[model samples]
Target: MPVPAPTLAAPGESTTPVLAAATDVTKSFGRAKALNGLSLSINAGEAVGLLGPNGAGKSTLISLLCGLRRPDAGSVEMFGRNPLDPKSRLQLGITPQATSVPQTLKLRETVDFVAAHYPEPTPTAELLVRFGLADMADKQCGALSGGQQRRLLVALALVGRPRLVVLDEPTTGLDVDARETLWQQLRDYRSQGGTLLITSHYLEEIQALASRVVVVDRGTVIADGSVDDIRSHVAISKVTLEARCRRRPSTLGRTRSARPLRAPERPPWSPRTPTRRCAGWSATASNSAASKSTPPPSRKPSWHSPAIRKPPRP
Candidate 1:
């Protein structure tokens, strides 16, 4: 889908002020902590990307921001009001990782249904066309493909014309084209002074859209800065190599310095070495006599037998 270039907000339009904040928030599941003393704040018209690996608590923080869950300690506020307050969330929109709409409902009907909940919403027809769902307007949600359904899920979030939108892995299963389309829509929203909080594992996703990036790992923020600043701090490159060699490598690549192993090395195995040395001369003589009597077994010339012998169990 091709969208017209988004117009920039007027000077004052972009100054809508801080919309959400999570101060020293901590949340846990059973004995596992999901978020620990995390702090974040977002203002109107800013696009902030929450970057993290799996199980990094990005979702937990989002749940608290959307008022679906509460922090065990610290606080979360939306528009200076508790996130749990209905009025505070009126200006918020969310598209969680998984979404389910009435399977039997037509796409158009679903949009209309969601639109009815808000006092003022983007026109249903306009929303549908903007999201490239005009052709599937009458199709049942269940009949749409996964990509189409994902587009609809995100479209519904914008129906309320929310000032702040929170998308969790919004393009998780989308193709390149679908993902780009969604990105354009989000860009337009931010261009019009809307605040965005998006969490994704794809670095390209964050780099393309986020002015500021927050990297989370093991339930805490590890890096927070403008996208460029964060990139500068993490100026590392990844390289992969494949080669055939008889010996294992002590280092991955010759271009990089290698650190020696810290642990002590074990002694090498040898066929001639006995399991244990005889404690005394009598014990040694008895072992020597037994070895002489048995004689050394003859070596097999080849291991090319049709059936190989299984090793004896210890």
Candidate 2:
């Protein structure tokens, strides 16, 4: 039997779903395998994480989800409607990779700007305060701090009062607090029955906020399930630490990688460490790597710092 998800029964449309359903979606950019065959199902009130590594074709998936591009093969449907249809556009929220909100526009202007897209949007005041941007409401999105920009983008996503929201690296440059704040916001959105398809690199973010995670590698759906279930598929480790004036990483909790037994090199699998520490430290497998093929990470975190103090659970 094909993977089964809810399908709405309506006249002239025996094949439609309340959320989204794609089958054998494939896209190719020359020789690069952008999407071999990817499929995902998102339901109302659900928060599903879309995960992958560099060149994993995640951006392509987002583009297809938003109706920005046509797949070379397969089908996509949203809420008993097609994404490319103008009618379905308003029912969805999208935060793309491009520095989404325009500059020159004050934060308030941006909010109001997006509000214009809908006949009735949520109150601007509520979105501003919910994202801790009341003070910066008059500032241009271009001038706002990275975290602030991300927050405002999220606010825009909530404007349409959409039934489905797709966030691409939503917390891309946010501080731990800001990221955690958004995490809570997502949970609240889920509680209100808004569905979400989130693409992120933060493993813990998916673990904490996503109801289910679908791991994609090279355009293929390699793994999909709850956090525990996915984590159990790969060999990884966890390390704990307190606030530190000075810290060092330890070998105690480093991962026991199944050498050469690659598992997509996907999310929930951070790189290995060199040595150890007590006051403050993390663990991981360590080996010299020099492929000269892949570029360095966009951001390099300091291990000598404090643990990302997550907001107390809701």
Candidate 3:
């Protein structure tokens, strides 16, 4: 399937203006460079997936976007204001990779405590019900399961009713059911025109929630597009072969096939060799005694061993 093209507008210019932007961002810790000239702009009402392997500077970028940490170079803006400014963060929410709620506080109390800081906040009861935490509302935070706590943490981020939300591995330790529930909640948020910037290692999580995907590798944005475009961009051809053992005549070595199983249609000009099939054979010496033998041929040669020979189709 083809991916739709992106609609772009400068910050605060169009009807749906850019809600957040990181321009030429650079950050370093000690001797390690976490981010290098990274730039990303997110518009209103969009769910963008930030994907990368470990040590890709994804977490660092998130911190800069949320104003938790300033960039070493360049600048970031939230709602057209500097991210470091309190006014810029008034409409922002974030769920960090790890969070610790007061052990003595009940779930409702914790929600209320967080809600008190915002001018307009979602009601604690309604928020708890939306996050499937109504039953545990009166339970102490320390008594909740890891999955339940994770759900509450995400719920807390939304309690302030921020226009833009950043979730860093929100479902990291969640079970399949809980993860799906959270995905549904995120989808519901998007339906109401809320923007999301999420970083996750799970490709399925990104596929389920993001309309756009940004692939980062070695602190660089390598690919950016819809799911199909990213998939097609990274797709490659693979060859499969069957190799036969020389010593163990009856025992065959079954190697795993190559990846990306999808194959394109044969070109019109290509000729088909209907009878040809792949066969592999490796030479081995059984004796430790040195034998006066010549080196193998330098050119590619055909395989002639009987062990690797297959009978012709009848």
Candidate 4:
């Protein structure tokens, strides 16, 4: 399949490729295939969202790019060099799914150690506050909540002043305020000409930040292109509107129909919530009804819903 160059600067400014994977890269564990000939690329100052369902080889590819493990076949490169090269360590930053920030150490101490590796490092104070961990600087990582811990992990990744950052579900446990704050930080990083390869199940987040997306499954690149192009491939958008007036408008820009929603017994499952998916959208809406009837239309859901929906077959 044809893959478009990521949404980015004119091709001339590319000093060297930031990320490139090619050929039939495959990993087999006896009977299971983790990644198969997964060819992909990312450019500097660009954000590429690597999306796939569970066991889709996203994390495995990240590991190969970071040199955490050697690929069983094919090849992966960063900055036009092999990730196994010691030099790649200095140019890459990674925020893993689990909090890698050492819990036994004070947050400041951990950051200082990592920053010491860079000639020019981002100020620790700025990153600490931006990630909501300023007041907790002296506190040990073990004392933090899941959200705070995740924030610390982000801070560590940025302190190294990397050329390319690989983030694996970086916002997994953050509250709304914290999550938005990270997005702003990422925008700033990209604006400064940093390259980012991110894997997120949050499709909305991908839509908001990624200029290009690579959908990988069973170790293969199933689709790769701009977000608009991918959405065009599916070619339909779903529109659902819920308002405080107790009656939804008949149409919300091509909406075929609207369903009257009922209050849910609980919210949806979220790692932070300690409840089920019921605790997520459900509880939020239930609480909103008294202070405010319903959530305002979400821009992500509004545009992305129909785009991912498969069109009716003739």
> Candidate 3: global Cα-lDDT?
0.68
- Model 2 misses residue 30 by how many Å? 2.4
Pairs clashing within candidate 1: none
Tens digit per residue, CA lDDT, model 2, 83-202: 788676788888776556687999998898888888778889888998889998888788887778888888888888888899998987677788778877777777776778888765
TM-score of each: 0.72, 0.71, 0.72, 0.71
C-alpha lDDT score of every prediction, in listed order: 0.69, 0.64, 0.68, 0.63
After superposing candidate 4, which stretches have Cα over 4 Å from the reference? Answer: 1-16, 20-23, 236-314
The candidate, 1 or 2, that scores higher on TM-score is 1
Weakest lDDT window of 10 consecutive positions for candidate 2: 279-288
Which segments of model 2 are wrong by more than 4 Å?
Answer: 1-18, 236-314
> What is the TM-score of candidate 3?
0.72
Error of 2 at 267 (Å): 14
Candidate 4 per-residue lDDT over residues 1-314, each given as its tens digit = 12223445433355556554445677776788898878776776678888765677899888888887887888877777788886767878889877765779888888888888887888988878777678988998788888878877777888888878889998876666777677777777777777778897655566656777777767888767766554443222111112311143333322323422222111121122111221122223222212233333432222223343333222
Error of 1 at 213 (Å): 0.2
Candidate 4 accuracy as lDDT: 0.63
- Measured with C-alpha atoms, the lDDT of residue 54 in candidate 2 is 60
Q: Name the runs in model 1 displaced over 4 angstroms.
A: 1-16, 236-314
Tell me the tens digit of each residue's lDDT in model 3 across 118-220: 8999999999999899999999999999999899989988988998999999998787678767887887777777888899865556666777888776666
Question: Model 3 residue 78 lDDT?
Answer: 91
